[model samples]
Target: MITKWEVLSLIWASGVAYTAPRILNRWSLITTCDPIELCQGCRDERRYVMQEGMTYEVMGAAGGPLQVLVEAFAWYLKPFLPALRRAAGRPPLPTCSKGSCLAHTSTRRRA
Candidate 1:
C-alpha cells in the first residue's frame, strides 16, 4: 500500500517529469537563431526570446516592437488555411532555403 509520503513523492516526480521536456523545448526555442540566410522562420522561434530579452527593448516607456499578438489569431485560422490558400491564378509564395529564394522558376504543386 502506498503511504501518503510515497504518493506525495510520486506526484512531485510526475510533475518534474512532465515539465522537464516542456521547459527544455522552450529553452531551445529561446536560444536558437536562424542559420538559414533567407529563412525568416526565426521570427516565430525568436518570439520565445523576445519575452526573455530586456523588457525595455521589447516594450518599454520608449516603446518598441509589440509583443506578438498573432499567435491566437493564427491558431484560429489553421482550420481554414487549406481553403484560404486556394486562388484561381495567383502563384504560391516563393519558398526559400539557406541562400536561395526559389522564385525565378515556376514552382509546380505536387499531385
Candidate 2:
C-alpha cells in the first residue's frame, strides 16, 4: 500500500506548499529582521542597560544639548522595561497596546 513513489510525491507536495508563498510573494525580501533578542526579558534588559548608559552620559554632560535630550528620552523609557520583559512570549519588542508595562510597575515593586 505504501510505495516509495507515493512517499516521494507527498514529500515533494508538502515542500512546494510550504515554500511556494515565500518564493511567489513579491515583497519577500522586504520583511525585516527583529533587532530585539530572542527572549522578551532579555531584550528589555538590553534596552534598560542602553538607556541607563545614555542617561549617565547625559547627566555627566559629556554630550551636547541634543545628546542630553536623547539621553533624557532614554531615561524616560526605563519604567516600561519590566513590562517588556514580561511580554516576552510575544514579539521581542511588542507594541504597548495591552498595558503590560503598567502591570510590571507593581511586579517590580515586589522584587
Return the top candidate by lDDT. Answer: 2
Model 1 misplaced stretches (Cα beyond 4 Å): 34-111
Residue 7 lDDT, candidate 2, scale 0-100: 100
Worst 10 residues of 2 by lDDT: 24-33
**Model 2, 1-111: lDDT tens per residue?**
999999977776665555444332311211121323223443454465446556666556653344434434344345787677677755444432223343233334545
lDDT of 1: 0.43
RMSD of 2: 19.2
Q: Could you tell me how far off, in angstroms, the CA of residue 76 lies in candidate 2 after the best superposition? A: 51
The number of clashing residue pairs in model 2 is 0
Number of residue pairs clashing in candidate 1, backbone atoms closer than 3 angstroms, sequence gap of 3 or more or interchain: 0
lDDT of each: 0.43, 0.44
Worst 10 residues of 1 by lDDT: 102-111
